[model samples]
Target: MSRLVEATTAEPANPEPVFLDFSSVQVATASYLRESVLAFRDLVRGRRSTFYPVIANANDDVRDELKELMRLRGDVLMVCTLGPAGDVNMARLIGDLDPKQRMTFDLVHEHGETDAGELMRAYGESEGLKHTTAWNNRLAALAARGLLMEVSQGRAKRYRPLFEDA
Candidate 1:
């Protein structure tokens, strides 16, 4: 008779709250996909928020993991990043989640910086997007909705979150 070997891996007994940020290209890679799932599960052991800038190529898998985490913790907010596409994508993703149970917010400001035009131009070139009037319109909408607040309006308009309770 041949002896059979069983391997066991220990999971997190107590998980800590985590905020996940993923790169669009990274999520598409097989290695990153596996890492993302494991990282998400480990992060959600206690409480977690899965934040992504936009619906990248790897959104499906991330979304699936988020759904499973929600089932366990009951407090998962999937942040869909909306660039120049506007609020349609944001609304669609949030609508798919448990609307009444979870809270949704468009992550507009980072580190109390809100000059989106300059920031967009600098970053959009790499993303294959343009900094145009249309982009400004999209940003305006977010500002109107209280998602982004302008601290200084001039050549450079610094922006930050409306509230920093968290």
Candidate 2:
């Protein structure tokens, strides 16, 4: 007979989280970069939660600068957006990570109306990517993440920002 070992340990408490959204970094100058880094450090050092700073389009120069800043401080996650729009290609990246991820960016826009078929076609033309189905899938994933809003449904589905009213 073997005795089961049961060691008692107290679970760790949750910490406060922080979220930062940056739509564009190309406009941020060197001073802005320094200030932002300081702000991030102050916000994250005493917390035991996640910190996400969204930097869109950070071109080669911006990316290099930020990378250097990030190296000095190990508290931020830099999400580099690739494809037609920044961060919109998250689905494709996810697809690369996990094959099980769904591809759902189908839906077309005509006269301000959205249709599944048309949307897929437009996505292909706009991005010059071969996978319309994958684009649709990625769009759907973006919707799920609150980055997009579905405007219409059925044969056509239109989407806009959740912040449109604002």
Candidate 3:
């Protein structure tokens, strides 16, 4: 642990987000995970928010163990994929988002880019949303969470899934 900390101390002041690509790594034990990753996480502590130490291409067992860690520790670990599509824990991913934000995120994720009007119409029949501003706010909230992106279309806005430039 001390050696790991010593090595980490030499990391660049503004370190790039670490990507733990597990494509080649097939197996791991909980002991090694605790010794390496948990220790690293503790060493870094909280000098950041959002993406860092992202694990990608983790197999089912590894992902499950990481999920267990997250459940117990209550800390989020971002996951990255080589391509755009991948699965993540939607409930964990949507932390603190209200119903509208959740719905907006779902809509955007399901259908690529969605305009406010389209979203409003989709839910309008059920929710009685007559004004456009409410839908805008919902999409904006999702965008703020980095789950969605806002694009300009003439005088309107469209929300799309936040695709990382992997």
- Candidates' C-alpha lDDT: 0.37, 0.39, 0.58
Give the best candidate by lDDT: 3
Total backbone collisions for each predicted model:
2, 15, 0
Residue 5 Cα positional deviation in candidate 2, in Å, after optimal superposition? 47
Residue 11 local lDDT, model 1: 25
Model 1 lDDT on a 0 to 1 scale: 0.37
| Cα-based lDDT at residue 65, candidate 1 | 59
Question: Model 3, stretches more than 4 Å misplaced?
Answer: 1-78, 81-96, 163-166
What's the lDDT for residue 47 in model 2? 32
lDDT of 2 at 38: 41
Instruction: For each candidate, give its TM-score against the true structure.
Output: 0.31, 0.30, 0.46
Order candidates by TM-score, high to low.
3, 1, 2
Model 1 reaches what TM-score against the true structure? Answer: 0.31
Model 1 misplacement above 4 A: 1-107
Candidate that beats the other on TM-score, 2 or 3, i.e. the better one: 3
Across 23-135, the per-residue lDDT of candidate 1 in tens digits comes to: 35432443443355334433332222111112322266666654555455433333443335432233222123242111122334334454557656655666456764544
